[model samples]
Target: MRKYMVTAILVVFAVVTIGTYYVQASQETPPNYKLTTVQGDASLVEGIAVYGNYMIKDSTFGIKRAYITTNGTDYPDEKSAISQSLNRRPMKTQLDQWIEEHRQFMRGKTNTSGFYENEEMLAYVNATVDTKRSNDSSAKRNAKLSISVLNKQKNNTLEITSDINVDHDISDMYVQNVQLIDQQLVAMVFMNHSASGFVSEPQIIRVNLTTKEIKNEPLALPGVKSVAADGDTQYAWLANQNLEHTDQWILRISRNNHRKAYQVDVKTGQISPLTFQGHEMLLNNIMNAYGQKIYFLQKAVSSKENIGFAVISYDLVSKEYETTLKNTHIDLSENITYAFKQDHLYIMGYKNFKGNRLYVFNLTSGNLEYEGKVISTEAANQAEDEANMDLNFIDLGQF
Candidate 1:
């Protein structure tokens, strides 16, 4: 009888202990885990987002955002968005870095392409329309383009405003780009029909900085016709980077079932078609042009029928293949995220159980330059739960 009483008392004690632990666990929870760079140059992983579909508890999942950087990760949250607070630095976790770098000279910026900055100078373009309404009867509007330039080394500002040379209505025109080549300011724009709501092709406006004289230059695509309103043909003029220093712009004409890239000498007003040596390149595959070469991201397949991916660099002058970046180091089995900037390519391989790995390549040299990985900083006990975590790598943050 005494043994039976002892067994019953022990059972009651076990129940009470479990209930107390459960209450404590429910009251306190740990912070969310973040992904950090394990090894290699942390600069390779900077400015990219590690989107996590993390396993919260048991089979449940939660979404989390963390900005990867070399110094440390910044998890942007509600608290990190308060600007005027006492702790401003801790709260200033914005995604884009463009405004932070060019905010000083970005006044009168009408569009994204209206701003351009280099080591020596900063340039901006603004378009405005002055309307004189005669009792609102189809108001007369005058289009004006303003150029603001700041020379960093000389520490001086030059401002010029010119009336856009357009015979028709330009009230609906917008600035496409603003680039500086020595003393000339180039403003590319598109005019929309106010009545039909149609967007026309890109037009170039040249401003002689020294003379403050403005002139108009047309896009010279000799025989290529525009796509009609009700046609199946889709057309676009691909604008690219490095226009300020290159003294020329690579203009790509893309149409339905056809693609042709052109090298327009901005200074001399010369237009020529860029040649592709072997297989024809599709418009969507053309990444961007830098210097005298164009890059393409195309898929490749081997004799064994194994699928592969390729990044090709074509020399515009020679009309030949310069470099093809296909290395054995890159994982061919999983999905990859890539970004092309200047002469560098940033690639990230997706790994489900193992953390995602980063790969950086030099496009000019066609070499795999650096490698890094994404690691979890969660508790060791949560290893099983973390296996369900899904990380999707978006492109590198735009500068």
Candidate 2:
């Protein structure tokens, strides 16, 4: 009788432990949405993954990890889990976790444009100004160049400072973009004339990482009075909202709406005008560039249930504009996100708890190569899904 009681107690304890574990696992697992191929080769999107922020109605909820593809080549389920609800478990998305694990040193510093990272080191640049003010013209402003670098191999960080000269009227300086060329740190900066809210003057600043010497170079343009910004207005952005390492930067600078495009060589500081005088076609359109061609979305219309736009492309090699997708405009629903990779354009439409669709376009041939829709494998509670309805994709990459 005593032996039987002990056995029964052990069995009950084991069952309770297993049940508790299952409950925790279910809570951690995100809603499963599988991709279903509707046309062409769906496998083309196996390398692309997108991560986004979720908003329920009006407030911030959490983040969605890298997207799941139909094929097994994308982000693994074990690693890519959605982080939901601030009141619940304080978990981070897969993208955030990856950045933390891989580029741990750049956790807080790389938010702006003045930073460069590679497998060996991560570099950052900024300018610091002294509070002392003087009336004499010869007394240059007390400004210092701030540079920081993290060596991944040695697990060491180096901080350097150098004095920089500026006129008395210059009030502030900001680093826009940074590059490391031949052991030298190059930073594109914007200098404000005063504290007033207005456009800034564009300039190039260079610092020797070893010698800690600072040098200033003036950025000059032809015809266009200013090259401060890339046609970005006070409220709108027209260029591709992505970053990549390049030897040349395309700049659109204009006054009184006569916008003209120019390419600047990062190495030689040479400025050459591009033939694309596309002020009408590029205004208020989302554009991304690949190779010598530029793709843009125009005539974007959004309603309660659907969103669509016309696709157009301009070739720098041929100096010609062409309309993609024939006479048909792309029809998507709710929110849309797109990215360029592997000579293909990947676009997705997702909303609420229900599954959505994916469209792939071959950039070289200008044809729709594949279409896929997401299929929900598991049922979700309607109230919970409603609380997590809205989403905004913030990042895209091959995860």
What are the TM-scores, per candidate, against the unseen true structure? 0.70, 0.59
Which residue runs of candidate 1 sit more than 4 Å off their true CA positions?
1-62, 80-104, 108-112, 118-120, 127-143, 165-178, 190-200, 222-228, 231-239, 242-244, 275-277, 282-284, 302-307, 328-336, 349-354, 381-397
Total clashes in model 2, counting residue pairs 3 or more apart in sequence or in different chains: 0
Give the alpha carbon lDDT tens digit for every residue of 1-399 in model 2: 999999999999999888765565445545554456888985675544334332222223334443444531122323434423322111243335436755755565533566676788777787767767677745778788878888878978888878877766467777767777778877777665443223455677877778877788877756543222444321112132223455555555544445555566667778877655754647446566655666766544445344465567877667788766432345564556776664577776556423445677886677789876555455555345334433334233322
What are the per-model numbers of colliding residue pairs?
Answer: 0, 0
Candidate 2 residue spans exceeding 4 A from truth: 1-108, 117-121, 127-144, 149-158, 165-174, 191-194, 209-211, 222-243, 254-258, 275-280, 300-329, 332-344, 348-355, 367-391, 397-399
Tens-digit lDDT string for candidate 1 (54-75):
4334322243444443333444
TM-score of 1: 0.70
